[model samples]
Target chain A: MSADLQLGASFRDPSGFVFRKNGVLLRQVNRPYLESLKRLTDSGLYGELTEAGLLIPHTEVGIENAFSDEAVAVLKPERISTISYPYEWCFSQLKDAALTTLRIQSIAMKHGMSLKDASAYNIQFHHGGPVFIDTLSFEPYDESSPWKPYRQFCQHFLAPLVLMSFVDIRLSRLAASYIDGIPLDLASSLSSSHTRFKPGIGMHLHLHARMQAKNADAGTKKETRGGFGKNALLGLIDSLQSTIEGLKWKPEGTEWADYYSDTNYSDAAMIAKHKLVAEYLGAVSPAPNIVWDLGANNGEFSAVSTSMGFQTVAWDIDPAAVEKNYLQRRADKLMLPLVQDLTNPSPSIGWALRERDSLIERGPANAMLVLALIHHLAIGNNVPLLEIASFLARAGEWLVIEFVPKDDSQVQRLLASREDVFPDYTQEQFEASFQGRFTVIKKDSVPGTVRTLYLMKRRAS
Target chain B: MKKLNRALNIALACGCLLTICQSANAYIDAGSGSYLLQILFAGLLGGLYFAKTAFGNLKAAVVRRASMHKSDDSASHVR
Candidate 1:
């Protein structure tokens, strides 16, 4: 596979397309967008936005580096360590992203510019916060024009947010199915009757959906006269901002959100486990640049990698846990916390299967921490130990895994209800299954607990 | 109350003009109904925003005046 490749998600906007040349990511600004680009820099909007950390900063490279003849300029943007989608973000992450977009729009308007689109995909978690990555999204403000991205904003940010707040948190996964945004109609239908009383929800979701259906066939191509004034546009942005602000999700009540408090490990064992993981991390040869902590409940152990200065991503299935982790690590620029269900992880989705990378496609991270998560997959989820080992082998190079025996209180709790059909879930079976794929480097029992932790290196294919 | 009434009137007028007046040159669809809703509510929303900002400025001015008075009294005492 070639190291230099054009990003699949970058082609939708005609202003420019992001591509890599000799492994360095660059965006080519087309001739049509040259004027907008000039206006952006000249008006000082770019400087203010980048300074505020609302927009991604980029440096203009020579036009000679253009991928195509139509390119007027090329930009070398500060690279994002990880590209996370809307679906992967927990409630607060998505809300924060939405708020960030609105803030940028307001600031752009002050500079006589406006955002061309309001796609959530344009927002990426960079430098510990959400940032607008699409430089081409800004255009010269038309005082008479309505906010063109209004519908898209509602669908992408507003609808999903309302649904998550009012309907169910799990409905956020609808973002994955509907690549553009969750359909407003679907969101409206799912919403409870009481949501209609809330002015913002009523207008944006229910009324907006009704209007869309009514005008589905209405010819919008014809030219006409009177315009949606600038004040109105500002008002619309403000209204959306307040509406989103009002929509809040408290990260509590979920099982894993309170995992550390409810754990069986003693204080000494907990401290020892943390120390052992750090020790194993230091022992890994050719220190890893990136570390992924799977099943990172509130990112307790992921902190070990972040403190060690490795770019770490904490993935947990619980939204509450991921939200808590995100809130706690807001200042850690090297850490990204996200929600992921290991059973059905994010897959390659969008226009083609290639538009968005699947969970595995993004990795084989330099190191992966599968701490206290084996039993859930093996016994609770009914996945075989061999399959679990095989998946983990493909996910990272150096594996730091904890094997929770059936006798462990947590594992026994899981088996308290279900029949224990898994006779092969022993520690001996686990080592046998993984030994084929990884070479064991270090093994130690966590001081006061029955749990065993191992550090292993991926065997060369 | 008068301002609110005027805003509502303007909104109603804009709603009436929705079918006749439309913007063009959008790359994305910018659905007809969505555009109409914005046009219809533009007057009321804009008025509300204007009123809110105006009230905020008024309150800030009052606070500034009171603070100035306090400083002037303190200076007089010093003299």
Candidate 2:
């Protein structure tokens, strides 16, 4: 109600909206949507999904909370971190989130509640599962709510998953361009000519979209008379399930997806480097709940944070690399792996900057793993070392960073193709540049490699 | 296989925490592997037990939570 906290095109949900205050994220439950929340919670649907780890959990903020003036009751989530979008996710990530949504919907129906919406953005990677985050997505099932979000589910989840599987791996990014989900009509047209008739795609994508537009334009804003009874709704869920099951993308051998199995590290080195991070993390007083491992090649180092129960994202650039990391994530159900090119990270786009949180908005990771990443940005990407220092200062309270010198074999290869113009790239220069922002606490080098690792803290506020 | 995956993930999560106890090896550790395997079997047994007898225990708990809300959007529609 503050008229702030507005972002993207979230204005369309007449049900309610999400907001944050004093470092806690909360969703406002308007006066009208009370019944749905009661129906959902009363029926045991919320409890089951939470215990199964399929949805984000919320605690009712006592009435005395500040926003009490506006909200019926404020809810505080356990933890909030980088909220990536559908377009940001690799194909497997989106597909998994999609399937998890369907699974939750099926579970909800069993207990006499139904998901009022199926937007992919509602699901997030939490504790190695696709957790639903929207507290306002519930409604009492009368066999007539018409799955008010049926069309939305098609546009948001099924359509994108299908397009990714059938058309191109990059099509998921189209979600950024069309926040309401890639328009079904547009998705139908852009889809390959052959897919228009593929039973699931034809009906759900091509024909269903045509029918929706036709019905929408038919001047009937009122709920339809078809009255989808419990049987019909369950039937619809089964239909969607089969459609999703039939749509599959066998992981194509991508360049980065196959990276970890092909890295230069030996067994001893991987273990040693991993231990180094754990040892570094062990020194911090209060356990940090979030960590960002920038340049997390296939997430080996980032795994340290998740192992400690901190929500972590292992960000690498190459889609193939991310795909490979994601494949392992799928096989292992690990939550730490994701693909991001540190040099050209994700940008906020959509209705307003609110649709997607900017990199800075989503960060400061409580701690960060900037190992082997500084040299890439400073030397390979031509970013000033001081700027890198400033960026890291704003990103985390504590940092476990690695600085590779020009003499390191990896640095040599990075500069092999470029000019040797980095005059101030010495170890002394590195310390001086970062010392302005960070108090270097402890510094050590790996047993075999000449790379230097330092644990530093940001200048106090 | 499904229960085994969850069991393995939880084990590896725990194992990663205890990584200091064992030296880093090139392959997965034997003791760690055995512990995770036992979890796999145990997790399966637990999953089955829950599947057959899930609804009763949490129904009352959920009702208690919902009653806290003064929602009007059919929140209490479920009996």
Q: Say which candidate scores most in TM-score.
A: 1
Grade the docking of candidate 2.
incorrect
Model 2 DockQ (Cα-based)? 0.01
Candidate 1: which stretches are off by over 4 Å?
A1-3, A221-225, B1-30
lDDT tens digits, residue span A175-246, model 2 = 877877877668877888877545445555665555544443243324343433455455455446656776
Global lDDT scores for all candidate models: 0.87, 0.69
Give the fraction of true interface contacts kept by model 1.
0.34
RMSD of 1: 4.1
Looking at candidate 2 chain A, the ten consecutive residues that score lowest on lDDT are A216-225
Error of 1 at A58 (Å): 1.1
Off by over 4 Å in 2: A1-14, A66-71, A212-216, A227-229, A250-253, A326-334, A349-352, A416-421, B1-79
Q: Work out the TM-score per prediction.
A: 0.93, 0.75
lDDT by residue (A1-461, candidate 1, tens digit) is 25557788888888999998987899999999999999999999999999999999999999888888889999999999888999999999999999999999999999999998999999999878999999999999988777889899999999999999987888889999999898777898899988865666767777777766666656552432255687888878877887798898888898898999999989999999999999999887788988999999999999999899889999999999999999888999988999899999999997778789999998989999999999999998999999998998889999999999999999999999989899999999999999999999999999999999999999998
